[model samples]
Target: MNFKIFPALVLAAAVTLSAPVGLQAQSDDPAAERIPIMRSNGMVLRAAPRASGDEAIAAAQTFVDNFAALPALFEDPAFPGNTQPAAWDNFDAFVGIFDEARQGAEAALAAAQAGDMNGYSAGIQTVAATCSACHGPYRRQ
Candidate 1:
């Protein structure tokens, strides 16, 4: 019950619990890491159009944050197994899709904040389309 020992133990336990989840997402296999993020974003994007302004804003924020995790997950040579080599060949364009998605998410968030639900819905849908644009040519069977 010593105060010093108690806080240290709590910190240690939290780190112990978190390390595996963090490490697993950073695993060598891109698919393992990418699939969950994609699914989560898909859920948000799918529901965002029907969501209220506040809900759409929240979804957009989640997408903005999620963007940070994606770029590092794919590289030129070693990428998600489902990714076609064409993505690497047209790497700049491929990367631009992600940037465009993030920007669209940001626009959605801004529109929701400004009380423009129509703009918000449109922006969110545009962001969702980025997946198809990238995957159409870039995803292998």
Candidate 2:
């Protein structure tokens, strides 16, 4: 057999053999559904800094709403790479952080509605801290 043709044939065979495994691995990843939610959450976070008055209130409300659902999402058995039993040791704590974030967001919303920039700034800070606290311990770097 010609060497060039032989290499091409071997490459094709290898790809065909690995295709199912690759597909299966992709299917096994549980983050696919969660990525969009994360992106939406990011959009709300990004908007918060630029928004003021009603816009800020709206953004904060959106942030609170998204985080409110996180506990249920995180509790899902199919939550991305959350397969290891040890990963769930602090599951309740992780969920609790979202509650804290929701409260922060609510405070931000109230401050925005009242046109209190100082309070809004403080509320935003609280929300950010909550995110950092949870991510530091639970999220993959």
Candidate 3:
């Protein structure tokens, strides 16, 4: 899974999400259900200090590939899960979390491609930290 396919995946998700909807809440939709799973599974090996460059790059691309559309999914008011009001109150900062994650993943990909496994590992940490960044203020727990 190359990062080149990211834009197309995001575009497709946007198109799918933009379709007409009934009054029902989207909390149970497959996309909503898949978001957390993706986030968890996508980073399962992020903490591995010695994963091969190939493995690291593969993980980075997989994250970018699957996560490109999450912002759109999360933007839906009726999406699943309890979002803290501060997320909407400071929406730009909330969205910045995703931006940071994407940048980190991209940097990881670049680092792995360049045979810099150390930087790739650090970039994975950068990517992982965004979860805490967003969750601190944007997730109800």
Highest TM-score against the true fold, candidate: 1
Query: What TM-score, computed on C-alpha atoms, does each candidate reach?
Result: 0.75, 0.68, 0.68
TM-score of 2: 0.68
Order candidates by lDDT, high to low: 1, 2, 3
Cα RMSD of predicted structure 3: 8.7
TM-score of 3: 0.68
Q: Residue 141: error of model 1 in Å? A: 3.3
Candidate 2 lDDT: 0.68
Off by over 4 Å in 1: 1-27
Name the TM-score of candidate 1: 0.75
lDDT of 2 at 48: 79
Question: Candidate 3 on 55-111: residue-level lDDT in tens?
Answer: 777677655544454565566555546777676677778777888887888888888
Point to the candidate with the largest lDDT.
1
lDDT score of residue 42 within candidate 1: 77
Q: Mind giving the per-residue lDDT tens digits that candidate 2 earns over 1-141?
A: 788799899986874453233223234443554455566666777777778888888778766766665555555555645234434786777677788888998899889989998888788888878866876777776
